[model samples]
Target: MKPSFTFSSNSIRLSYVSWICIFIVLLITISLLPIIWRGLEDFNPSDDYRLPYELSYDYWMFSCWCKYACSNYPIVMIGDSVVWGQYVGLKETLPYYLNELEKTNQNYPLCANLGVDGIHPSAMLGLIKYYGKSISNKHVILHLNLLWMSSKKHDLSDTEEFRFNHPRLVPQFYPKIPSYKAKFPQRANIIVERYVPFSSWVSHLRLNYYENMDIGNWTMQYPYRNPFNAITFQIPYPEDKPHSEPISWIERGMTKQDFPWVSIDESFQWDSFKKVIKLLQSRKNKVFVIIGPFNPYILTDESLNRYKAMKKDMENWLKNEGISYVSPSDLPNEFYADASHPLKVGYEMIAKELVETESFKNWLDK
Candidate 1:
């Protein structure tokens, strides 16, 4: 004989056993909430890991740019932080400046900035693999910084443990590096991060969100958060700072003996750079490699020589390959935003120079 269950207002009153079951179910749902939220989003664990040049925040910000640019088919610009235009407003960025130039001059195709900070030649390949298909057949202006090739051999490892700061999550494609408690005190932060829905936490925090609450297309801006405090505040430019005064960069110290830069002629980064160029060519994209100007004022004599050599070698390579490029002459330090990145004046100078170039004009007309 089997026992039959019956329900009545009084008879089915909440019992200890029934209440315990309800609590257990609720607890399980709460624990699994973040996991469930993560599964629904566009987040990828393997690509989220940080390298020296790459940061977790950079990937997220770049993803936003990719999503926006993929649908527009604008002329895409690819490169490192200089190209990324860090510490500047979106309006002040290179792509924005180029587009503004296009609007004024009636250029054929508008430029889209797809630059990300800490992007080496190898990482650029990764970005192309992830987002290149979206901009296929479009003209791409690649900012080739010689410093990318000068990375040390040991710095080239994409799989090293300390390269990433985030605690290892269930990887999508690659194996994860373990997170030690000593190193990553907040190893489980991913759970909370993933559990929270984008609408709840991420979207509201964007630079555009602060600019306007409309949640328009251009939501990502220069993340002006305090590195130490994680506080997002407006950047205060000193009133006395002359428009001609260039912002100093900590990396300007790299020109000293402490920072050794070897020739990148035989580097893993060089191979990766070649691979990216080939990949772009295969896709029938017209590639224009632009060599941006460096801050000559801060460079030591040795560093200056290194820069010149790199530039000459690059020119040789481009000449051999029959690639069209715009190599800007050295500019005053006042034109720079930092050690590497350009200010508004500098970016405008680059665009103007490219516009003046017959090769660039020929490429655009085609």
Candidate 2:
């Protein structure tokens, strides 16, 4: 008879260790993958000011920086991430352009950026009522992003492309936004609370002191895709088709019909829009309400036919409200950095239009 040998305890433990190693290796491999492959890699600046999870609060901090920087100036620009340009420095930003133009050609005599990325429109009303006391007499260029119209609360974040990337930095700084989304990843974001790696801290330091300043698009992807100059986007609607891939923000595009007309009697959004207008008029300052540029998604080929049919009704209700609004749809597509965001070229076109407009000239004259 042969003796039956049982497996050794060490053998079982060794097998378990091997499985653990396999799992860890898989995680690392997944994390390093390019965004092109649905990998969970971050495309932030390599050196690190990347708080492990700072993107969420860092944006508002940018707004706070503007609040601090603008105390000396008179004109203020206010809105969402389109105003921030994700990875760009503050000086090369919109306010910086206004400042530079004023210094050279003297366009926006004393303009400053009061823009807050991710700001809600209702919050904007409160902000204007509160912080806008000084700027009331000043001419204001308000970019009424159509995305806000689709929002339930009519706030910027409630719009289609809402993203809450990092929640950890919230409690440390903006407790309000973080508190609302507490159901999000709290424990994971807490990792950022500890010491940020040396490389990460320098990320913010390097970009903040960027030598040139003209290079603006920050959410740019490199390595796989070719070096893109600008990114542009149209508006987003409820999609019947699932997203086949991540958006291509670097491409140039256009939209025929922006702001799909929803009847005031049919829904509350129309009424709320009226409230937003009321809030704008409530201000004592000259308001230059602008219909910012959009990519062509605002109208599908079918939707375009519908928009053309309803153009008369839509215009009568919204366009004739004595608002100094202009749609840059007539401008070239290369003007955008992404859907709805104007790149450097687009900003110049916008500036040119502002200079030419009778309303803008009148406001500047005052």
Best by TM-score: 1
lDDT of 1 at 42: 46
Q: What root-mean-square deviation over C-alphas does model 2 reach?
A: 15.7
**Predicted candidate 2 versus true structure: per-residue lDDT over 1-366, tens digit per residue:** 666986466643558888899999876654443212212212222111111122323332233334333454466566555554433344445555556656775533366555555544444543444334444455666765555443233322233433442323223233133123444355444433223322222233233322212234333323343223222111112122211222334443333543453333432333434455566567565566665555554456665444344433434565577666555554464445455566555565666666667766676676
lDDT tens readout by residue for model 1, 1-366: 665975456665789999999999987775675345434444331111111122323333445445456456457788866766655555566666677667866543377667656666766775665434555677888887765543353225333333522222222223222322223334355434434434223432343224323334333343454332432332222122222334545434333322245555555556667778888988888888887666666567777777678678878888799888888866665665555667767877777777779988888876
lDDT scores in order: 0.56, 0.44
